[model samples]
Target: MVVLRMTKKLPWLLVFMFGTVTASEFRSPSVAEKGPLRYVFDADKPGSDSSLTMWTAYTSKSANKAFINHGTSVSELTKLFFNESEFRLARAFPNCLVEQAGELYSPLLRTTKFKTRAKYTECSCIMGARWSCPVFEDKGRFVIRATVPLRRVEIERTDQSGVRGGAELQDVLTVQPVAKPSTDTGVTAKQSVAIRADFAEALQQSNHKNPALDFTGKIKVGGHEICTFGSEDTADQNQTDATKCLAVVGVDEGLIPHVPSVTSNVAVVSDKKASGSSYSAVPAAGGGGSGLSYFSDTSGTYANLAEDASKTVADRKTDQDTKARMWLIPFRGNDATQIEGVDTGGTMDNLRILSEQVTENPREWLADRGYKFETTSDVGLGDIDIDVGYEHLLNEKMKAEGYIGVRAPTGRGDEYWSNPYQVRRGNGQHWEARFGGTFAWQPFTWLTAKGDMYYSFALEHTEKRCAAFTGADIKNMGPQVDANVDWQYLVVRLDCNLFHPETQSLSSVFGYELLWKRKDNITFSVANMQTWLGKKYNSTTNAFATDEYALDADVAEKYTNSVGHKVRFETSLRATDYCEMFIGGSYTFAGKNLPREQDIHAGINLTY
Candidate 1:
């Protein structure tokens, strides 16, 4: 029995000497050669193929606060209304200019019903009628209060007396006319006419009284008139009343006028309709010209309606900064009642989100509509880990170990349709138990030095999470519970190794871990049941609390507590006497709330 052969010396232990090779093993050895006691198996390689570009998150511990790449938060957009002045919306229905005929006792047709103020130079469409009126420049003026939908026609009257309220049977009623733009009207004429002026009654209603004309000049575009009404002013030569002298000439120089300017025409003969002409226009007014032409005289199609009203008053003063409008409804209130939680009755009518106006920075307009942060990933079988340790050498240069494990629960969980930086493959279905210890030494002939510790426990079970409510709640938004989660953790490592001599089969270890997690006592395993918008009403158990959101304590203070600190590096090789292969990567540079992640792995261990 005098036979022993050795090779493949130490790549984290797998030494088996059998027959031949001897020369006293080339002497110079003493206590440093048998510290692996065997029984380690690994496998790995189901997920990560490493090529990441951007994705990081750490809830808090301040590395300048990481939520890295594609982050967004202004409390997730939904606020909906604040008004620090100037936010006049209006336009749910007014602006009918005509269409309502039935009862006419003529108190002026009983005060004719429909006219909230009409005056135009350009919301065009004459013979074929289609008038819209949208001109907004509020605050610095030029406000055309919109809501127009005109174009209904009918006319005729012979009258017959009836119903004891004077000749009343003329019936037909629906006249929506505001026409003038000939050439068989296909209507495409607009040369500035944004009315809403009161320059002290526009020079006492000018019809060109011309005392040397000068309703304060400006009003050109095609027919040249920086202040016309002169050349002996022929019947008030027309630039259609320069929209009431541009409301007293304020659109400086960049004159704005070309034609079609009726500026208010309220005329009524009602039994239902008949208006061959009507008048009450003041600026540049003077029309009895038979059949809709309140004012006309062209050669203008706006070369500068004051540079489009100074670019709409600098885009309405940059969209008036923030009249403050919000409606961020992640559902739960205003009837979806979680006791009216998302800022009192939220309702964007189901978030079709058509800009109820945030103007800018509503998280950059919801990150240009894609709403940012979504870089998912996933792969199979992950939370397995099944240790059964028991190594014990204690000399040849030290060694010791002890293990007990379970882990199972096959991985992957919490996938309410992903997106929350998606990337799940395990640990969420948690089932752990673990319990560890390691100690290695091998003081030299090629280094070694280890120390490890572990603890997991976690058992609870019920699963299906996602409902943080607020803590920068990364939008998983409401509903999805089962609870009873336990999550406790604690790890610790410290290693170094670097062999490679006569097939120490290439080594290299290097490590440093220290994880720590505990804060996810999440309960609701049955507490008050759970309904979320239906049964609610638990004024501290005053009756009605089958649970409409009551796992309480602000959701157990939103489960926090985290800590990390990885930094590993591997590189093994052995390849034969019981196999061994490895590949490395780890790097959670620091800790807190966790997920700094920097993966990359590759494995195979098998050393029974």
Candidate 2:
């Protein structure tokens, strides 16, 4: 048995010794005899690691394919980043701003087979693609590093009368990190291209530490919020109730104002209070002013001021690019059902403007009181307001401003509703004066607070007349002289900034409007207008086309005790140094049988 085992193992041992001797005695082939070889490294593979050596791949075919794939992915990702960057964003995709690879990329790749746990600016299956990347700093300088694969490079092989050059591929892979001056914003093209060039050169140099991971991208911070409320009126006087609900959201998201219409549209505020100053409102003839006019709208529906005429009063346009925030509400059929029922929303395509009618000279901007200014509103049909105010910087930590504004009856008011209940006052032109001030305090970058208060007084109307329309006399109705009425409102709001940064912020705003009113009942018949138009009272589409409706009764509704409470939360993202995007929503609890009004708006503001 021992002899047989030794004989069986003897042949295996002899074969192993012969193979070892042949390998040891054999001389290495020369470079001319054998082809050069290299292992390709890619971290995109399933098991790729931070260690460059571990990422190395065998087989030239796989390496070549990966090289081209990496190049293509990098190119495509660069293009995506360019589009999302602040400089050339023609269309914004905030929803696609940033996301994880596994969720957002698989579909784009058209296959569920590929997914990654890596985070990316947008989703894609190709590996090593990035944008809006976090800028890494070494000391005070921005460290820009790029790892690029090179097929070949040409350098001068000889300097003769006739130029000569030689091309060569890298024999080894090295790494080098480049440094650049940091901008307040993003990476420069020179930094990107130059660092990329360094990647190629470093690969030819002796092996060194792997270059810092390269990320060419940007960052943006933004969010949105919505809220809602409603109420009816009852008189409650001498109430010093300060219900404090402090919140901080953001700064004024400035916007552009709408241009005025060419039609004869007039705006006015209404004051039917028995205890306050009584003011009359008048509709202009192919004209415009601001006021309040009311009549018994028996049907309880009314027209939209925007449908009949223009609804913007750009009091904030400056000589520079108009940094103005304008409210754009679309109005369809006139009526509370159409306006507040929330079904008749249109677009801001008919953005119109009602200027201050003040001269264009810069000197005209200054009134004896202060400079002209405007604030944003979450109200319907927006406002045609003109305010003259002075702002003073009390100190580094605080500032104060005061203004007296004349709200042109030029905005969409209560009278904008369709008839039966066309008792819409705050229509036509009844100029009202408002005294208000803003006090702002910023204790630190993370915190800020502001107090805003205003009181509006109904001034006596320049003219007073009442008109009545009966069944057939809708077109030709004479005006009758009528009398005195009064109305006013007081408002106070507090705003706080909870999170504030150069590129992002959060803020909260809460306020209340207290009303003072006592108006006689206003009654009007829709039959007369329907008869004139030769259409049924329900032919709402045509009946509201014209702005020539009037009332049959001389009384206005009494809303002695009314008030509105509102809260708004807003957030902003600074996509770039000059561009900011913001969104917010608010619900107003209005008083005196008024419906709760809600508003939500979002926009991007740009500065040159």
Candidate 3:
């Protein structure tokens, strides 16, 4: 048996040695020497499948164009092509084995045949072929083998033009894998638990980290689904639906990290009463709250009048039965009792002249009463005089006072004037005397009234020439009255001159103002005026004449016969607490044919 085995292997060993010797002697052909080769697939073969079953061809003409085909078998036709041919190994044959004959050349020769066990289960077939076989008389036939992956084999073929060319093959063979099977029950359970834990942690973190996240999906816990409330519509639906119960978790600032605690608490208390409070404890008068008193006497103590009266009576009675005493007593008395029963007897003949001189030059007479005198520089023709007088207080409101001064024109005395009748060249001088008493009364808190009345005589003297050039110099005696009323936002005032003209003619003016305050810093006021001239004057006649007389005159062109109407508007702005600015304008419409005139004034006042 050893000898037979060795003998059988001898032929195979000779074949292999001969093949190696030939291969060593042969040289591969150069690529330029080999010609072109092509493989042609028989796509029409019935039930026969090849490994090159689904072949696709692409052309360089256009990207979108291609060709496809599925074949049952393929054959290489190298003899019909040019010389120096080369063949690239394409896909292998299915369900078949391939081998090359001795020393395969450039245009190689190969053969394939299907296995005996390879069966065409459906419309597929296995075939064999041979090439350059030693047993065959001519070139051998080539073969291809294939089997279907599933029940039926379907093949596709494409050409260079992307045109598909194939026929369906029904016969197929199915194969199954020989690996182990798998089960996912444990994996699915683990995945469910992991997902639930992740969702719960995400919810808890989002409540504190990011409060804006909306978690409204249904969560399954313990096999029960709980729906979360998100929107009004979802809440309403949950309320109406019996199968779903909404679960809500509200997030507040307290749930967030690092929120500070409140520092204080608010409480409500009722029926709390102050202790030891009485009506007298409040205040006797205007004691508390503003710290001002209503009945408190802010003016000092009252004076003793009885002592002053006795002193004055004794001083006057010491003078003898002289004519000067007679005049002085009546002038100093209150009424006419002493003046009517004056005894003009005794050594009083020269006394009358002396008294008359003293009355004429009242400065010397006032000097005897402890008054002082001073003079100022000449102001044009007249000198300004200042007399500060204080009286001995005899009562709370009355006093005995006297003044001594003269404000005469500069060139009026005997030295500067050649003739006293000659006119003064400048303004006139005035001689004035003043006497008054002040009284005040306050009947209630926040109410006070004070008044003062004084009799004054002002004598103005001017030479006839100066008077003609600079109006007139007449004596004007008058009493001026002023009253002020203050009531919060409303303020009123009255000022009148009882004797305005030397003829005792009275010219009075009364004005009432209404204020409308729109803001704390702005105020507006309107005022009405009722003014009348007691007597009318005519400019046409150049004398005191009525308007009717001036209108009837032959030359009435220079006269104005009508009264004027004036309207004013004022506005003020408080820029600061101590500074204010105001603008006011007035318009006056005069007689017929006269234009409406206007006057505007603006000013700013600052107080420190």
**TM of each candidate vs. truth:** 0.22, 0.28, 0.14
Q: Candidate 3: where are CA atoms >4 Å away?
A: 1-385, 391-427, 442-445, 459-462, 466-608
Worst 10 residues of 1 by lDDT: 23-32
Candidates sorted by lDDT, best first: 1, 2, 3
Consecutive 10-residue window with the lowest summed lDDT within model 3: 21-30
lDDT of 1 by residue, 1-608 (tens): 11111222122111111111111000010000111212121111112121101111111010112111222211111110000111111100011000011111011111111111111010101110001111122101111001111111111111112212111111111111223345676544322222112111111111121111111234321222322222322332222222212212112111222222233221100011112221111213233423222232122212221111133433332221110110011112111111111211112121111111112332232234232223333323334343455444555566666766565554443454222233334446657786777777777757777786778776877765534332111223223556666756777778787777664667877777776666667765543322212333343544443432233423343324556666777676777755555665555665554434444444444332
Q: Candidate 2's residue-wise lDDT over 412-517, tens digit each?
A: 3333211111111133345667787867777776666767677776565422323334211111112232434345666666656555454222333333333323
Candidate ranking (TM-score, best to worst)? 2, 1, 3
Q: Pick the candidate with the highest TM-score.
A: 2
Candidate 2 weakest ten by summed lDDT: 21-30
Instruction: Candidate 1: give the clashing pairs.
Output: 78-328, 79-326, 80-325, 80-326, 106-109, 107-110, 334-345, 412-426
For candidate 1, the lDDT comes to 0.30
The Cα error of candidate 3 at residue 336, in Å, is 86
Model 1, stretches more than 4 Å misplaced?
1-391, 403-433, 445-448, 451-455, 461-482, 487-494, 497-510, 514-565, 568-587, 590-608
Let me know the TM-score candidate 1 reaches against the reference structure.
0.22
Residue 97 Cα positional deviation in candidate 3, in Å, after optimal superposition: 99
